[model samples]
Target: MALDFQRPDPSSPAAVASAQFTVSRRGYREEEVRDFLRQVSVELARLLERERFLESELKALQARGPVDVAAIDEAAVTELLGAEAARVLTSAREAAQAMRDRAAESAEQIVRDASREATRLLEESTLEASRRRSDVSGEAEQELELAKQQGREMIAEVRAYRERVLTDLARRTEEARRDLERLVHERERLLGAFERARHAATDVVGDLNEFDQSLRGTGVTPPLVPPDAPPPPRASRSSDTPIFDANEYAHELGAAHREERTHEVSANDVVAAEVDPTDLGQVDVSVVSGSPATQTPSTDETSPVEPSLVEHTPVESSQIQESSLASEGSQNTEVLPTSDTPEHIAEVVNIFDRQRKREAPRATPIHDAPEHPVFERVEAQPEHEVVAPVTNRVDEIFARLRTSNTERVAKETIKDLVEPEKPAVHESVFRLRDEVVTPAVESMTRALKRQLSDDENAALTHTRAKRTSLTLAAMFSPVEEHTQRYVESIHETITSVAVDAARSLSDSRRADLRSTVARGEVMEAISDMLSSDLLRPLHERIASAIDAASGDRDALATALRSLFQEWKSQRLSIVIADIAHFTYARGLFLGCDGATSVCWVVDPNGPACADAEDNALAGATTPGEHFPTGHQHPLAHAGCRCLVVPLDK
Candidate 1:
């Protein structure tokens, strides 16, 4: 509602309505306050209508006529006025109480409405705040999950990178170690070769000296002897001394030198210088070369280049070479007459002579005999016959000239084509093994190494693709393809060894064996044997090895490496042995063949156990009449080194 009041500036909200009050004893006339009274009457009427329920009883009593206060009545009027005043007083008190009750009800209702509005606003704000908080929390959780995922990926990447670095470092380190070992091994080999050459030269010097001394005693003009060469360096002894042990070579040939020391004679006394030549098988041929040196001109090629058992101290070939080279440019070179010698032997002798002629001269040829092959020219045959008789004589002279190396086989005990190993592999077996098994095993190992790398990378990268993998079942599963390749390589090596062994027999004998059994049948049996004895065991061994490695990748690789090496080395040996034994036993199967019967020879010197040796010996001979089965094969087991020897009737 709008209201206006009289003021000095009525439009301003700060302006106050003002009125002057004149205090007097008399009351103000009604006419003077009529406007204020009329305003009051209208407000009073509106207020009564608003509180009509509270004023119903007052309205009912208002039906009585009005009594004016100015109309004075004496005693009668005084009593009547008293009763009316009492009734009006009662009505006014009742109306005032009802109005207070209504006001209280209105105030309570306002408070309740305000309280409800405030509660609704508070609830709405709280709900909106909760929703925003929830959204932010959800976003934060998503970001945290994303960061965790990124961190895991980064860790995997870093770990993979670390693996690569370590693997490279390990490979380089291994290569360097192998290189160092190779260099050290080469150094040792060179040192040994140097020592052996020095010893040989020392021996040559001593021999030349002894030859000159013998020539002087025999009344031939002795050549000037060479100065003694420096002693060969020796291996350090337990006492750390550089001196060598007693010369075993010199000791063995002490008999030849004993005669020289025992008999001293004048140069003119040929009879006294003469010694029995029977004990000197190594002596007879030496002076014959010098005999022709005294006289030249034997042009007869068939003149039995007169080999004699001339007992004299022999000269070293090195000295012969030295003397030869010194006079090579001065003399007409000999075209050597061909002799009936082995082709390989002739080739070797030719090479030796050519080498001697071309090599640096070690000693002067001032006393070289004209009979020396280099000085005397011989007419050579125009064909395959290459080495001449003079070359043969020179070869024989050189053959006995140095320390006899016959000690290597002088005793029957050391006579073997090749020594048998714990698991015997014939030396000839290597002819095919190098071509087949070794390369296969190497490739297999390389494949395994690659597999290890792949599996390792897979493990690093796929850690959480499904559930975390904790075991090795997924890593090193055995590959059948690798095993098959392994089997084929072994088959190739063994088959080749067996075929070569059979081919070694005479053609008729091979036919006899083939007649006794079809070739394919024999091979099939052998194949079955290999499958059972070799391949099955190989697979089992690999499985056992993998199982033994547990879950460790390095351990698995190490086990595989060792197993592959064994397959290449020891297992190959066993396979070759069994195949060889089986091949020879084939001929022995039928008595008509070259082999009459077969027996197992357990090397007394081998590593075979006593029980095994005895068992082998007990069943050594398998008669041709009673053909042997696979069970009777000479190879008892993987490590058995027994030999199958065929006997003729």
Candidate 2:
């Protein structure tokens, strides 16, 4: 298949001619041919030498040329040709034989030349074939070397490709494994959170119990404490007890002691005073008289006498003693003591009569005395007569009572002015988009359900009501078809909203803890929260709708079931939150430019904004079209809020 570049050596005509001459002429000798001829000549020369030797042998018995040369024998040849027509015949024959030998030699020379040319051609052809073979072998070796290099390159390429494939496969496998691990870890985290939430409910119960116990221990008697314990003690007593005792006993005792002790102690005290001017003494007087204190005293005891006269002389003392004895005898005659010994007192003439008689005689003298004395006389009034000034106290008390009543009236008037009057708390039905529509839908549903089962012309009544209600639709729209379309639109909108909410919640949740939140507790808490305005709207509307239904209890139960069903389908996201960050981030949708703008907030550490921004974002419905219509998130209200923040590290 490969071409050989060797042609017939590009032979010229002259060379061809030369080669032909060398073959045909047999004596041509131009360089290469000469050398070739020389070799032929040497061969011829050996043939000649052998011919000579053979001729010599022929001379002895004669051969024509050499036997070793394989030449014709001349003599044998002459005899065979005809021994000379005796000489002439022999010469003719010999001539014929010589011609034959010469012709044979020439033929032999031509044959030798032809053989040499053939040999030369063969040698050149052999050389050309050898060179062509060498060239072909070299080419084959080079081709083999190139093939080996190509093979190595192919192997290297295969290895690189294998490595790349392995690297890609490893990357993909690692990515898949990481994704799986992340999912598993997320599920675990959800389970942990769910368990904690369940525990929180129980923890709340425990907290309530602990709080109750703490309150019970704080001074309020616990149920465990006994009831018959002693009462706590107190501090002051009545002041009148001591004052009344002193008034009852001291006055009587002091008065009785005054008369008995006056004479003896006064006399001794006077003697003591005279002997020692600085002496201060109290005289004790005992009252022995039997007469009552209310009885009149004798005139003799009332008369004033000079104490200096009694202390001056015995005669004066004797006169004073006589006067005192007579007066005492008269006093004893009027008021006797229970102890009637002479040591106590003695009977005497009527000194009281004598003093009375003397007082009548000194009446003019007494009347002649000075109008004003050195000492002022103090007259004590009776206790009964002293109370006369307080006679109008009852009237004053009545006046005070009237004044207090007027003041109380004035206080009430002032209170009325100061304190705002509270409007009477009454149940009112507030009509709002959710409020009115929610109840109406509930009512319609209940009515429809009732009509579906009842046979009291219920369906006919409902149809009539429906028609009448539709008639009222004229207030908003004139066309009945338009009203129907609107209603259908509302239904579709609400339904779509509900379905989306359900799907979002269901897809996000990784766990549930329903068993931990008992129905009783949930209901109790919900009931309490219903009092707040945040929940009041929904709670009141629901309650009212239920109450107004044809089959109230059943309707309420059905409604509750619907609500719960919706919640369950959404994984209780209305109450339970998952993917809380995404849900909270939805608020950012508010105030967004619907025309062209989109927000690009940082979720670097998950979606947690500051409290102020978050608050500003709460319940800001993203226009009518953007609001999540039937969502039941517990934090959907104006005040309630929460969010999630992923911890990347």
Each model's TM-score? 0.23, 0.19
Estimate, for each residue in 29-69, the C-alpha lDDT of model 1 and write its tens digit: 32423443344345445545645743564466456755565
Query: What are the root-mean-square deviations of the candidates from the true structure over C-alphas?
Result: 35.2, 47.0
Residue 591 of candidate 1: its Cα lDDT? 29
lDDT of candidate 2 over 1-649, digit per residue (tens): 2212331111122222233333325454345444434444454455456556655655865345444434546665566444442354334334435434644665576578879989999988975665455435534655676699999999999999999999999999999998787667656655554455445444433343444344323322111111122323544433321212223333343433355457768877676565643221111111122211222223343233221100111123344345446544554243322332211111122222334433422211112211111111112222243545546889999999999999999998988896433222112211111232344344434432332223112222232233333111221223333223323323432333223322222332212212222211332333233223212333344445445654444444344334323323332232222212222223222212231322122222223445423332333332223223233222334333332111110
lDDT of each: 0.45, 0.36
- Residue 529 CA displacement from its true place in model 1, Å: 7.0
Number of the predicted model whose lDDT against the real structure is largest: 1
Clashing pairs in model 1? 284-309, 284-310, 337-388
Off by over 4 Å in 2: 1-88, 197-649
> 583, model 2: CA deviation in Å?
84
Measured by TM-score, how close is model 2 to the native structure?
0.19
